[model samples]
Target: MHILMVSHFFESHLGGIERVAGHLSRQMIAQGAELTWAASAQDRAPVDIPALALPCVNPTEKLTGLPMPIPGPGGMAALWRAVGRCDAVVVHDALYVTSILALVMARMRGRRVVLIQHIAGIPFASSVMRWVMGLANAMVTRPMLWAADRLVFISDTVRRDLIGDPARRDYALLFNGVDGEVFTHIGPAAQRLPEGKRRVLFVGRFVEKKGLSILRAAAAMRPDISFLLAGAGPIRPASWGLANVHDLGPQKPAQLAALYRSADCLLLPSVGEGYPLVIQEAMACGLPVICGAPTDRADPEAGQFLRGVPVDLSDPDGSAARVVAMLDAPCLTLPERAQMAAWAAGRYSWAAMARAIMGLMAG
Candidate 1:
């Protein structure tokens, strides 16, 4: 089957949705399916796959020492032309004007369109921006839902969020998968820590939704453990005053692999998520993950794989205690780690996700 994959950003933007799109497209091509990518013009070149670039409607502009909004022109004609020749169109992220245009064009052409709802609900944005997004969802995204042949959500929580209307059918719960082969190799825990120090890794954006403040508070609570914060965001500082907390900035996949191998455990105190890829990556590397339970939060699918595991985020004291326990406990043996890696490999494979999408297209 011929497929067209559409996303807002590509080529190492390093977001979960971007990574999923890249992984899906590559695996689909390997499985003997023709795939093409459509993204913004400002995107970096040599995507290592066939792709089409369109001018970025929203350009970042500085005005009076403040950043200006980037407006994207809806490329309906171009998107229609691209989807016309393909059997299915898979939209990775559905917030942008380009994606909306593609959704409209796909409905017009009677082609199968699959919308991947990456984020369940908006959080912590400006009131104006939140209202604008809400309005857009009501006007563009709601109608597009009616046009979709099927809806693909990374978690059952997301599926529940989209299942308000009984008439809306054809939805599936597919959790995000990781590349088990890359993280299966287990590295020995180094004994070079200063006296009695533990290494903890936190990977994600430095945003409100990610609960960076809670992480910082937890770090402050645990003075014996050393924290390494990866990834870039507007809210992150070049450095922090906390001696135990080290801001390593953003690291590539290779560097991250080394970090995961050396680290004792992964800490994710996020307030919102849609099947976070980092959790699976950590699990594949044989690292135990301590995350916030989805109770009171919007996304329930996060706790699906975390069954029977402790997921408490009630307060900083409780959160830090869990992290410390996981770090201080006996590490998983290599064989045991391999078993966890195998589970991740089998559960979240890109091939399986692609097959699920193919099933949607077939219907």
Candidate 2:
């Protein structure tokens, strides 16, 4: 089987969806399917995989931090041809131009299109922006979702929010997988900081929605606590110039696993997120996690291992104080960490995610 995957950016961007796409591509190949990945030329694709680096201009991403890659005429023509040859098309989300165009082209070519919707909505700080996003979802996203041959939601929260009635829509609730081999509990995790100082880790894009501002406030309130920020984006953590904040930049899985093992806890106070891959990776590495209440409860079973808190965009300082309180609390014990790792790895797998998607493609 030949499959074409369309995403806004590549795995090198350090976003969760792109990473999931890369994992699925490898798993599909291992399962005897020919996979061709196409994304914006903004970042590099997987080194050894077959890919079409579509020429695109990302002005929106530069200005607003939202990735919207618009392929040039030549790239669009190439994508049209690729759709004609592929047996099935798998799109990451319904929001991006690449995904929308892929849906249209796949439909025109009569190819089976599986829409893997990652997020339902983003609760932006701006009410105007929130309204705009809601309009986009209603006008564009829902239509594209309905037009696809099959729908797969990575988060049950997204599925429930978007398709309220489970029986009303034919969809699959598929969770993104984690690589347990790389992110596993070693023995007991030691404190990387000096004896009394605590290390708090935040892994993901440095964008506003990822709660960089709230984290900044939290770091200010508690100068004694160390804040290690991993992954890069328009919002530069180093520029914050806080003595307690350390920017580690983008990291690979192995490097991230190391950070998780040493860190006291993972902090992600972002809104409108599905269960982020970083949270799962942190849990797999036996690290405690503190994220938005909605996302922490994304998976009921996994929620047991997470610390959920309400995120108030209007009151970032108040939100920061709450995070500081969580930090001050006692850390997880070795046995509890081991239990968390066992549960996460046992439930999610890249191979299983691939198998389910392949089954949909086969149908």
Candidate 3:
């Protein structure tokens, strides 16, 4: 089936939703589906897929803060045109204005519109920002939901949140998959730590929602373990004086692979998430994960690689203790690690994610 995937950001800016969209688009193309992607010109060109760039709706007005547009003219028209040419349109991240426009236009065209929601909660912002966001969502979300032929959520928790009521059954859960081969090549986890120090890796944006402060406090509490923070954002510099932590900035896929290879475990204390692609990536590298429990029901298949640890954002000391426990636990053996890696390879493959999305499209 011909599909048009609309996202506000793409490969140039590496985020979870952007990565999911890029991965799905590539897989769909491999399966002989015609795919066209639309995103803001502010984003860099996507990997392997040709994309139509729309003008940045809300241009990044500040250098130090987040770069996002408010919604512009050309972007709306490009979205409409992209969706018009395809048999169906999949809108990733419903909160984005571009996705909302595509949803409305696709419905108007009588084409199937699938909304992919990545997060379960809205950002906790200032009263004014919260009000604006709530108003914007109210204006756009209902129409998008009505227009969508199907709603695909990355996790069961996200699906439930989007539907709001247990009685409402309008969405399906599609778990994010990983590229097994890329991670399988990470070789065995290094037996010896560099300089005999336990290396803990944190991958994701430096945002409050990611529980960066919790991670910082945790690192400070455990001066023995060395920490490597990957990815760029507002929170990176804020983590400044902790001698044990090293902010490697953002790394390319290869660099990330190396980081995973050298690390003992992946540390993610996110306050919100649908499904973190980094978890799969870490598992692919044969590294066990210690993450905040997803509010969604656990996936039975994923139990082996993940240890659901409790994180109290308000209590940094308690959160640090959790991280310390993870760090002190017995490391997974080579054989055990291999099993986790294989599980990730088998369960989270791009092909599998694409097939799940295709099933939604067909339904």
Best of the candidates, TM-score: 2
lDDT of 1 by residue, 1-363 (tens): 899998876656556777888888888898888988887666573357788676664443221111112224544456667889898899865656667777778888888889887665543335654565568667766666666778887865455555563425777767766776565545543333564577888887665556566677777777788887888766653454788887878777767767777776777766446667887787777766666545222334334334222333335466556645655656667776667766766667788988888778778
Worst 10 residues of 3 by lDDT: 58-67
TM-score of each: 0.80, 0.96, 0.87
Candidate 1 deviates by what RMSD? 4.6
lDDT of 3 by residue, 1-363 (tens): 889988878766767788888989999999989898888777687757978888875543244233355457766776777777899888887767778778778878899878887775544324554565567567766556656788777776666555765727577767777766566635544344456778889998877667687788888888888888888776654347987888888787767877788788889887557778898788888887888776314455677567777666567678778868877888788898888887777777788878878878877
Predictions ranked by lDDT, top down? 2, 3, 1
lDDT against the true structure, each candidate:
0.67, 0.89, 0.74
TM-score of 2: 0.96
Q: lDDT winner between 1 and 3, please give it.
A: 3
Separate clash counts for every candidate: 5, 0, 6
Model 2 lDDT per residue over 1-363, tens place: 999988999999889999999999999999999999999988987887899999999887777778888999988998999899899999999999999999999989899999999898888888987998999999998898899999999888888878885545899988888898888987445447664577889999988789988999999999888999989999988888898998989887788888899988899999888889999889988899999878887787787889988887767999998988888787778899999999888998999999999999899
Better of 1 and 2 by lDDT: 2
- Candidate 2 has its poorest 10 consecutive residues by lDDT at 187-196
Residue 133, candidate 3: alpha-carbon lDDT: 52
